[model samples]
Target: MDKRVTYCTDLEKSVIMSNFERRGWIQVGPEDEWNFYWSFTQNCRNIFSIDNGYRMNDNQIINHFPNHYEISRKDLLVKNIKRYRKELEKEGNPLAEKMEVVLPSGQVATRYVHLDIIPVTYVLPADYNMFVEEYRKSPQSTWIMKPCGKSQGTGIFLINKLSKLKKWSREAKIPFHPQLSSKESYVISRYIDNPLLIGGKKFDLRLYLLVTSFRPLKAYLFKHGFCRFCTVKYDTSVTELDNMYVHLTNVSVQRHGVEYNSLHGGKMSVQNFRLYLEGTRGRSVTEKLFADMHWLIVHSLKAVAPVMANDRHCFECYGYDIIIDNTLKPWLVEVNASPSLQSTTHNDRILKYKLIDNIISVVVPPDGIPDARWNKIPSVEALGDFEVLIDEELMEKEENGCRPTKNSRYR
Candidate 1:
């Protein structure tokens, strides 16, 4: 039997630990020698964190870790969206042509990028003035303002007028409050207005993405994700604009809704959503739509793969939120590094429980020991609901004349 200690600190992460113990893996204290270590914050000595942001010391220690997961850097993720228009413009990818937007320089930007997937976002303080000029062109357009580092629907609001920003700027002064400092400055993006509605409500997809390696860029998209529905019906009327329950699909915000369902948890299974779309849009169209979503995800990972400081021992499961428009095109909203594992309802508990279990199965060996160097492509059966997007080991196997079986499951 394999014998290697695994460590995790967050009590809320006990779901993961419970499964680890069930697998007969020994759990060790912080000071003990361990093969797998999980924490919320990165440790230089030998640790992995759920967070993506890191310090220089963390990077320096990263190289020495026999196995370590790279923390998702928030600044880097912000930059990915902020500079996406520019980068895709330079590359001239066809995807860019789809996201057409006229630059302030009068340069027509073709890259509707993800259409409604990613709201046209600009990094504030740096891009604030530029966005202001763009907004002046259409002051009636609604925009969502969000703080870079905060989560759980915190520091988010919608604005349809430029005067509010101007007023905030005037009061806070040009320097902006340290609370709203450039690092913490709000990422203001054009709000997605006409979302694909179900029962006349706005909703977004919360899909899980697991990354076992970054350099090789192996990822998996969970098929059994869910849709977060806003409790209030979506409306564009001026009076309803500030109603977060109508505008936001975040469960954290939706729970406060008087109409929120305790049984359904304001969520629907992704399978059910797929079935609904298939019934309405036809099978071929639905399949292609999901395939396109997969495409967007792979490329997004590629965009940040180079800058990701990866360690062999590290693995991460990201919560990716995507929104679809009336045209059935999926838009990238945001990627959450540490998605809440809390189970607010029975359905939520079951899905999250299975999610943690499957993740453990994919990353940990049968003997309960983690072999960081065993970096082979995971079998689909081991992945449960997830499908591999990019696997370097698979490529290596193919190059060496070892093709996977015809019945092999990979998407």
Candidate 2:
């Protein structure tokens, strides 16, 4: 087997350890070795974890996290998205509304984009040009444009005037947007009249999810995750970027919300809000919340099974953000392969640590296997970037591959 050690990093690493401990992982060591190492076991076999985010199998450590989303493979996530988009539409779901377009012309990369549109919905939107003319003819009615694949609620817009659309198509024709609209693909929809409310503010539900077994396809939902509210109060005031109160769910933006309050508003654990919503909005809303959560994960997984079932050594976790309209119906907002691992609070550390702990336990062999003790660092300078865990200075090198270098220096 290729024995190079692997390291994985996310802000959740620290918290994941606590989870490990909670699950009964034992920590053994300060062993004389080149790098820090830790071991834990389950089902009679030992599983390993590295203290840093380095992976033994990859060439270079990624300088950034959250930039890449790990799905079955590089192009798999987008392909899976296409499958799910078809599914929701086939079921005749109300959110199945769509748009049509003629492109500028180029190869279409289906794996990266999937939008919902229709040839025949009860309230049909004719082809792109007709939809535009109808809007012009009506003078008062408007439509929303949502682009697939972009995240954090970006690229969705409300177009009221024909001039704005002329500008959009013009922008799409630019050389820089080459792969986007060569013409054949587009998904347009009527915006929701009522996005759900919290603190009198509009927001979406961020439910955390886990895939325990993908071969047979098993998933587990944490009882809670978080609720991200748009920072502005609802208004016809024109949804500009700043009116985040109705548009953004990112904690980074919402914290600056007009209705923003760090202590009691922008962020609230799902468990806490379960009570708040019930006391105010009534118990039924919360009931639908759970129902919607289950449907989303189940349908999303089913949509992507064709690809996931055929892979091994690939990851299977996902973070799905779902929005519930005023009617309390759920709509899939986006799916994340590498969801945020940055622990935002003490609870974050606790939850994250436990998650990693579970991950390691699953990897350890069920029977006792050999322990490959590794190398040692020559000086404190080697441990760079950490304050509490490292000492400073260098000394010796060893040849055994499992022994620590023979000395130290900090004075």
Candidate 3:
């Protein structure tokens, strides 16, 4: 029997196509029989939709889960995380321990310390009154408003005053009805004004995580994730509020700025970032920061695992955007279902190409064939630059010291 993997992809990007070509995978149309499909998030929805009535065999696999928005959508992510924390608190988990947090107005508030990775956020206009209440408590605090469905720092702006929100709503012709279900919904989060700066400029980390399953979640973190730097220096003056170049570290937004550099594409390697942190801050503190980041990433996935579809044929590579404050606290900015395949520089191209190659290796079985029924765990040789983030099944086995019986079905 022919064992060459037949693949299909809706994307025309070189990073993805080249990887497929390098593996000698035959290209097939979406409607044709194929073992693998690299699909867009929208295409995934269509493929998995009940109306489409599409079914996959054990030999087929694809990227993205049916309900990935559980942790990808800005609003849903916050809702799921809040729900996860509450459930943990109800179970009396020490991980959900509450701690006192000081507000910008010098007032103190108690919050779940472990899950406090994300900033104080409220989805609007449903939470309009709640946002107002929180805003009044810290009248001087700056909050960033982002469209729930958008990406790449689009439709994002900072507001330090209530009037700015009102003016924005009015000018954008957005209805303030509490029952509104329009796609124009936004999430307003407290801005981390005092971000950790490198070379006097602000940047955000872009970490890639690959999830093979949701229930008994299996995940891997890519080691070569990079940091996207803002083209301009960090500034907190109210006058500079509209300067996206000063606040947004998204390469798409930064590339439009006059200070954008083509040579380096305004990016820094995460290794260099760690070195700088360890050198500037103490090594222990820097280590703790990275540890905390990993903890939050795992918990964030756990938060939405209950809601994820967890289809056997689906696996997703997510881009997690994170920002670290001046105090070395890493904040969960957002998660992307489909990270950009577009490389901005030569190094970036190589990194992303390797990323795609590693993803294929880990997802495909040892035979180099896509098989959804195969155990999700890949051999150490397949992991390339990716490190195992979590394997709940392996954790369970280690904790119990029990091996599966012959009759037991492998997950």
In order of appearance, the predictions have TM-scores of 0.83, 0.57, 0.96
Q: Rank the candidates by lDDT, best first.
A: 3, 1, 2
Of the candidates numbered 2 and 3, which has the greater TM-score value? 3
lDDT (0 to 1) per candidate: 0.70, 0.46, 0.91
For every model in order, what is the number of clashing pairs?
19, 29, 0
What does candidate 1's lDDT look like per residue over 168-242, in tens digits? Answer: 667656554444554356678888888999999999999998887778777777777999999999999999978
Better of 1 and 3 by TM-score: 3
| Best of the two (1, 2) by TM-score | 1
Task: Find the candidate with the highest TM-score and give its number.
Answer: 3
Question: Which candidate leads the pack in lDDT?
Answer: 3
Q: Can you write out model 3's per-residue Cα lDDT over 136-174, one digit (the tens) per residue? A: 988999999999999998999999999999998889888
lDDT of 2 at 366: 29
